[model samples]
Target: MNFAKILRACKGMQWQLSREYAFKSDLKIKWVRPEKIPCTKPEKSGDLGKLPPVNEKEFLLDYKDSRELQSADPIVQSLFQLGNNRCADTARYLREQLIKEVQRHPLDYGSMEAKLARMTVRIRIMQDELEQYPRNTKLKVALKELIDKRKKFLKYLRRWDYRRFEWMLEKLDLVYKPPPAEFHWITRKESLQKLTDAHCEKIKEERLAEYRNMLDEQKIPFLEDAIKKMEFVRKEQIDLEIPVSVTEEQIKDFKRELEALKSKREVKVDSKK
Candidate 1:
């Protein structure tokens, strides 16, 4: 196997076996075949970075910014109410503790205050997660696309970072790993696959050409002999005649059986006489 050619074929395009030699020029001239390549209308570019990564903080902000949900979605609002209740309960508990501490003659409760502060932040994070679930999903998609466009750049950087002395050792076989979720357009998938398919097709065509050449040079005589034997068998089958070229063992066995039968017949004739 030609490793470089195989890798290129696997990564870049679809592959198919072809008998014709015109494919040699096709590889140089096209990234994808015209028929296999999908025609797509250009999408209007939008500011992508405006969409932040899908985290708790980003989710909350996205929900707050949405036109339909300025007041917040009912489900998110319910979570927010539950979070607020928890906060009130915690604050009330702290206040009671503070009162008890004062009663016990305490003016310093740094540890208790810190605990309440931490509790408040945790509650807020939970609230954000509940409110921003949908917005987070949308932003995640946008962020994923941003990451995809930069993937080649990222791969190059990784290779560069890993490079020690030998450049070949640092080379990584990077494959496109799209987000493990749905996309707005299936055509994007089709296009990516088209490029992949074209590459595969080139490799297959090359390999098939190689195989046919090998068969002609090395294996065709054996195949021809098998074909001739099949033809001879077919002729014998149609004629119901014994083959002229029998194996030596088969001929010997047949001659032995015939001689035994002839001797038996001669004995019967002698007895009748």
Candidate 2:
């Protein structure tokens, strides 16, 4: 029985290891919903073969290529020609610029720094276009997506090469705001505390207002009467005519008088109503 139990434990450990490996491997493939797919859907359901096969190279090429074609510049015109299978000129220009900035020899298209540079340029272009056409939602969404991608790249670069991450940000003239370290609990607590304080303040204000209105209805000089009573108490203390206990008694008497006045005003208002 003990031998069987040990074997079962070993099998469980092995299964856990295999599950982790599968999860890690699955993360390499970018997941996308059908609606959020970056490419256009084929017109015919059976024309799947006509669509280009999804591959890393093709995906990177599509991202590096610009969608604009109305530019008078020759380079822009060449990069955005319709029905082009690839954006050779645009990719070459980006590669040359990134290679010079990194001060490295020719690196693969999949290099992190190279990808970061491409995303930065694309985001900058999209922002310029957005400034020109403020109502273009498509450009805004594309810019947001590009910023998210750049943030991920920044995280990766910061982990691997801290100096390189700083360098990239400076070179691109980008501002990197790190995400908050705390979870949702801190934010929720702060929001709840603010709401509670506001509620208590509102209740306090309403009660004070009601108290003032009650005083006004009674036609009693509440503020002036309190001030006079306080002044009389202070004068007695300075003259050594009354002790502290006597001053306290005077305050209590004043409070009793106000309560009686308020009750009488309430009865009169109720009878009138």
Candidate 3:
């Protein structure tokens, strides 16, 4: 291995450690997640092509190179095109479309937008290649580097001129995600804890709803008993000529509420059936 490669590796390790410490210390700034967090997310965006890396519409050689001849005779098509280097032709076409308006001059290829456009073409092609041969580590590494480089360019563009950055994103249909202030590992323990908490929350909500239904059921029976008892007491009070505090209006209201609840419960039961 090259000494420079080892040195770079050491630096990378040190950087990761510092980031991890920042995460563990819990003083990092809160980043507003651009998208909802799914139950499972990759360790990093680049690995496994998880970047959700900008969507690119492939430029087809059939359209760019031989659009007029596509509807022409088979003999004419065969004579006009050999059907080789189509991938390269498509990449060139896409690159031109991306950089045509953004380039500083006709000869400009090193501008930020120009480089980004070129990288985007390469990234798109490589991702396509990866789809066929997922075990190609070399291609995967190159693709990851290309993706990371594009991200860096986008980040710089965002800071330098946010308006241009927005325009660039719109043009490329790319989502620019800022580096997270804190990096937390998705450990088994942490994932299980989150899932367990979610499961418990669901169960708690279900149980609470059931408890509420039970209380509701009790209300009808309780109201029936209370009405019977109250009517008996009122009869006795009238017979003894005693003063009454339980008003007829109060009993009527209770009965009305009880009827409404009983009707609602019956509707639910009928629906279930």
Candidate 2, after superposition: displacement of residue 40 in Å? 24
Candidate 1 per-residue C-alpha lDDT over 185-216 given as tens digits, one digit per residue, 9 for 90 to 100: 44654765576688889899999987875654
| The best candidate in terms of lDDT | 3
Put down candidate 2 lDDT per residue, 1-273, tens digits, no spaces.
599999999999999999987964654433332343221112211111221122322223344455453334766454444234344444444545554675445555567776776666565555546658878878777776667767787888899999988887776655666667975533544655565567668889999988987766655576447847686767778789656534656676777776776787788789989
Query: Would you give me the overall lDDT of model 3?
Result: 0.70
Taking all chains together, the TM-score of candidate 2 against the true structure is 0.34
**Which window of ten consecutive residues has the lowest lDDT sum in model 3?**
38-47
Model 3, C-alpha of 51: deviation from truth (Å): 16
CA shift of 156, model 2, Å: 1.4
- Residue 111 lDDT, candidate 2, scale 0-100: 74
Q: What tens digits encode model 3's per-residue C-alpha lDDT throughout 152-246?
A: 88888888999988877766666666777999765665665565567668889999999998999989999999888888887888889999867
lDDT (C-alpha) at residue 106 in model 1: 50
Q: Model 2: which residue pairs collide?
A: none
Off by over 4 Å in 1: 1-189, 220-243, 246-273
State TM-scores per candidate.
0.17, 0.34, 0.57
